[model samples]
Target: MSSTDTGARRGRPPQTPEQAEEVRARIVGATARVFTRVGSRGLSVAQIIEEAGLARPTFYRYFANAVEPLHAVLTASNAGLVGGITSALTGTDEPVELGIALIDAYLDWARGHGPMLRPLFAELHDPASPVSAYREAAFDDIRAAVRGTFTELGRPVPSPLDLDAALHVCEYVVYRISAEAGPGAQPDPETVAAARLTMIRVLLTTLGTRADVEYALEVPGLFPPPGDD
Candidate 1:
């Protein structure tokens, strides 16, 4: 029997969740390269299939279209951004240390993903594009994580400097530092932490204690406690 027919005749053999997830991951990774090359407007299913080395018809088994898999790629990429920096945050008692770790992580992730993300952003921000939803969702996740950290820290819920705004400022710092510092610039831990703390202090003064309180409260969420979620 043909592979497709044998599979079909078995009344749909079960795939372990792990197995299914691996296939999905392969599809997502391949899509990143395709999207990076084509931009959102130019992206196509055939292109992703060609890049992925999969049969064209089989692409439908994993994704409805190019956009669906693109969302997954962006989501995984964003999660990695947060995960990359959390380990370096330890052994520092000051809140500024945590902020520095966060900023440092941002720069590291951006520098690595710039090529993939730069084109993705260009396609996403185009006025006529549907991919903006993915971008907005990613931003919302970042803001919520930041806000959740603040809320847990016993800080006020609303401030001129909430997680949403802090994210923008922090992202700009990361982008600028990466831009001007050059690829070889190795960030100084103490200095970065201190600079971040200063920025945090200014942000709090302008926006009020609510923001700071929230940061302290939500820090655990940002960097979860040992062995616990």
Candidate 2:
């Protein structure tokens, strides 16, 4: 078996939940940087160690190879976005408004984390070796949230064709917009902003929801705001 699969097969047990969480977080954060720097296929555990400031053995203590840590990073990114969507949905009675806010939140996250998102994009497009199952789960979660939002709005949950179509639209919109604005030969920020706004408007229209553009102006914080900032 490859070393990448060994950690799952045999590895030291966690002494405590906190320790496990810290190790997991470190692996993920490191993987994000490594993947951003080297792309998915080119990623190296040594690179992750350098980025994370952890020892070589410490890397193996958490993950078998770059792939596992990459998975952790993708999974964590999805979980964070899904959790934000859940919070936004539950915190408000108006699902329509929340839906708009969710789109903004997603775009904002992509803009801020384009480097991390790029490697997942590579994994998502990998044909011979599909290594993005974790990222796929994240997409599924987003779709589920979208479906639920439609139901909440008293609209029929989209037919499979429509749902698939809508998701593709969103995926493309987000990827292209972020790609243009991401580091290296960047476009004008105003142009990127215009494109993002156009995509958001198009997505909401296709999803059969009406919301104000001002909703985009108010990006929701990941945690509680201090005194309603």
Query: Whose lDDT is greatest here?
Result: 2
Query: lDDT tens string, model 1, 84-121?
Result: 64443443434545555656666567657755645644
In model 1, where do residues sit more than 4 Å from their true spots? 1-22, 82-93, 127-131, 156-163, 173-229
Give the top-scoring candidate (TM-score).
Answer: 2
lDDT of 2 by residue, 1-229 (tens): 7453333322454567776787678678877777777787778887887786666776787778877877666666777777776666565555446555666676666666655665555566566433456556776887788778667867667677766676667677666755665543344677656655565555555655334334433545322345764
TM-score per model over all chains:
0.60, 0.70
Q: Indicate the TM-score of model 2.
A: 0.70
Q: List the residue pairs that clash in candidate 1.
A: 149-218, 150-214, 150-215, 152-217, 153-216, 153-217, 153-218, 155-213, 155-214
Worst 10 residues of 1 by lDDT: 5-14
Q: In model 2, which regions exceed 4 Å deviation? A: 1-24, 91-96, 128-131, 182-188, 209-229
- Tell me how far the alpha carbon of residue 3 in candidate 2 is from the true structure, in angstroms, after superposition: 30
lDDT values for all models = 0.59, 0.64
